[model samples]
Target: MIGSFVLLNCKKNREKEVMMQLKKIPEIKEIQCLTGPYDILIKVESPTIEELNETITWKIRKISDVRTTYTLKINEEATDCKDDN
Candidate 1:
């Protein structure tokens, strides 16, 4: 599995619209409105890196209000931690 956190910068006053659009995509697992340089954050998962790339390039980036995106791919091994529960 491949997972990534995408930080999105959108055109002024378009955050909500962009978020709504992103929610329609199946690969986007989570979307959060943020208060910072970036307007929104999205968590996406895919079976392969190629599919993820396509989703980002062809789908996400195609949103008219989206200005830029910064993607951080998760490293499962480094992030794995046993739960204290």
Candidate 2:
């Protein structure tokens, strides 16, 4: 699996509208409204890196109010929790 964390900034007060639109996309696993330089944070996942790129470029970026996006590709996972069977 491939994953990316996308930080988004929307035009004016369009965060809600953008969030609504983002929810329609299947690749977007999570969305969170933020309070900072960026307006929202999005978690996207796909079976391959190419699909991940396409989601970011074609789908997410095409939203009407989305101003800009900064994406971070996840390279590794570090966790302390383990499942007990």
Candidate 3:
């Protein structure tokens, strides 16, 4: 499995709507609206890189209020699972 995080920059006054749309995407496991260079941070998992790309385009970018997105993928195995507890 591949794990990734996407940072979204949304159109002005559209954070809530964009977040709601994000929730409908199956690959996205979590999201939070925040104050920074991006408005929302999303966590996603997929079986392959291509499928992850498809989810980013078809589900994320397709949202009406989404202006841009920056994706970061996990490249190494975790040393700890304490955070999951």
Candidate 4:
């Protein structure tokens, strides 16, 4: 699966609406409202990168009051744990 993180910059007074709208999209697995440069952060997973690209570009970017978005594709895992028998 392809995993990605999206940072949303919403118009003033539109954070709640934006979050609600985003939640309806099925691929958006997790979301959070944050206090920082970005108003909301979202994690999404798809079967492939192209599918993710379409969701972000077509569905997400088309929302009203969404000022802009910065997307990062998750590429690698920093660590993994295993137990030796």
Q: Return the top candidate by TM-score.
A: 2
How should the candidates be ordered by lDDT, best one leading?
2, 1, 4, 3
Query: What lDDT is obtained when candidate 3 is compared to the true structure?
Result: 0.90
Show where candidate 4 strays beyond 4 Å: 78-85
- For model 2, the local distance difference test gives 0.95
Comparing 2 with 3 on lDDT, the higher-scoring candidate is 2
lDDT of 2 by residue, 14-62 (tens): 9999999999999999999999999999999999999999999999999
Show where candidate 2 strays beyond 4 Å.
79-85
| Residue pairs whose backbone atoms clash in candidate 2 | none
lDDT of 1 at 55: 94
Better-scoring candidate (TM-score), 2 or 3: 2
Better of 1 and 4 by lDDT: 1
TM-score, cand. 2: 0.91
What are the TM-scores, per candidate, against the unseen true structure?
Answer: 0.90, 0.91, 0.88, 0.88
Task: Report the lDDT tens digits of candidate 4 across residue range 27-72.
Answer: 9999899898889999889999899999999888898988999999
RMSD of 3: 3.1
